[model samples]
Target: MTNATQAQLSRTAEFIAGAKATVPLIIGAIPFGIIFGTLAEPSGLSTAGALAMSLFVFAGSSQFIALGLLSAGAALPVIIATTFVVNLRHMLYAANLVPKVRHLPQKWRALMAFGLTDETFAAVSNRYLLQENIQNAHWFYLGSFLAMYGNWVLCTALGVGLGELFPDMTEWGLDFAMSVTFIGMVIPHLKSKPMWGAVIVAGAMAIATVTMPHKLGLIVAAVCGIAVGLSLQLLLKAQAASEAQSR
Candidate 1:
């Protein structure tokens, strides 16, 4: 076999490896998609609109925020701003992929950028950054993205179609699934005292600002978390420096 053929096979294997790593993330999306479908009716969005959201936006958190604001009769601006803020994390995700993806064509980069959701971003970024001989990184992302996209669409259809069958899931505590999912995601990052402190401060700010219009409370929480996290991280660094100088 030619060297080029061998290299192509190797890249394809790497891509598949990246894709398989996204299974857990896809599993986690099912219940949330169901909830979104169930909530779409209550949020005043038609089944069609709800399904369209899953197809187009595809971001679970942003979709939930959009629904909450729509239910609250928020203007388009507020909904758009909140969605942007919630998804700003994508910028960081994209940056992490830069070292691995920078060599790809600009068009491929754009397509990958569109597919870069939280779960895929986490899985693909970790693999590409850490793994070697990643010939088919794009295929791995495609696998993860397609898996998630399918789950979102099917579950949403189920939710919207059966939404009326099960009313008031809030009383059943099902509404907390989203919060639980987020907590699960966030807890892993709180490996330091300052990280914990930032989470607490952000939680407090979010609750305190809950009355804000158009679900701005979430934005407040995110900002507070970033500010506190960065601030405490800097303080710890400075303290370490001071102690070294004193010694």
Candidate 2:
């Protein structure tokens, strides 16, 4: 094969590998997407609105929160602010990835940013962390993003259809799968004191602020977790520097 053809084949292989790596996450999110669809109409959204939200917003937690707010007759600004806060975690994800992706063109960066869901972040971050010399790694990121985005949209459509036939589908408690998936994602990454501090503080804060309105407690918990984690990380780095100087 010509060099160009070989390069194309390599990109395709990387893309497929990215998608394959995300299969477990996609499975976990399937029920969550369906649950969002089932709850959307009952939460006062039209079918088109629900699908459009999935296609456009593409943030499961934010979508669910938006549905709750809509059902409760929240103001437009409230819905926007709440969902925006819930998505602030994406900033952290982007920060973690900026170093790796900074060299890409703006259009590529923008597309990747749009596709950066939690699942994609986890899969891609793990890939970057574990593999130091990957070729066309962005292809792998694109593959994971496409797999997750397509799966979410498809599952949302399925849920919308199933919602009509089974109006009580939300009562099935399928969202628990997503919780398990998140826990699985987090547990494996708790390899340092900073990570442990973040998790512990975040969990405590979440429980403590569970009664906050509009799910603002989630934002509070996330902020607290990040604060503790960063503080610990900085302190550790300083100590390490001091120890090296002493030696």
Candidate 3:
């Protein structure tokens, strides 16, 4: 086969591999999507609106926040602010991936930016770390991104269709499963002091601000965690530089 043909095959394989590898992690999101679908209607969203959220907003945490605020009759600006705050972490994720993907054109970047989610990031980072020599890494990214996105949309539709059967789906406590999934994801990666510090600070702030109006504590805690983590990282880098110069 020609070298060009071989490269094309490699890209295709990587994309498929990425999608397949993330299938298990995507399972973790099923319950969350279902819970969102179940909660959406009772939270004052129509079935179409729920599907629209899954299609457009696409961020699980933000969608949940939107639902909660809507259920409680929050104003539009309040709902927008809370959801936006919950999704601020996406900016960090995007920034981290920029060095790897900056050479791509604007269209690819835009698609990638839209597809970057917590689950996809977990899948992509884990795969990229292991497959350092792989060609067309973004193909894998797209694979995982599409798989997770497809699962979310399908599961959401399922949840909405079945939502009527359970009038009090909120009482079912299914959303807790997502929390468990998140904790599982975080626990395995607390190997560094910076990570531990961020987790502790974020956790404490979250608890302390638990009763704040309109779930504003979620925003405050996120900002606190990012700030603490960033500050620690910078300090560590400076200290390392100073030690090197002294030597």
Where model 3 places Cα greater than 4 Å from the true spot, the runs are: 127-135, 213-216, 230-247
lDDT of 1 by residue, 54-121 (tens): 99888888999899999999999989988897787677677668888788888988878878887787
Give residue 164's error in model 2 in angstroms: 1.4
TM-score of each candidate structure, all chains considered together: 0.74, 0.91, 0.85
In angstroms, how far off is 184's CA in candidate 3? 2.1
Over 137-246, each residue of candidate 2 has an lDDT whose tens digit, in order, gives 89999999999999999999999899999998888888899999898778888999999999999999999999997677887898899999999999999999999999
Question: Which 10 consecutive positions of candidate 1 have the poorest summed lDDT?
Answer: 169-178
Q: What do the candidate models score in CA lDDT, each in turn? A: 0.79, 0.91, 0.85
lDDT of 3 by residue, 1-247 (tens): 9999999999899889889977877777888898888888888999999999999988888898898889899999999987876677788778778878877889988998999998788778866655666348889999989999999999999899778888777678777777777787678678877778888999999999999975678768877987888888889999999999999
Cα lDDT of model 2 overall? 0.91
* lDDT for position 138 in model 2: 90
Report the Cα lDDT for residue 156, model 2.
92
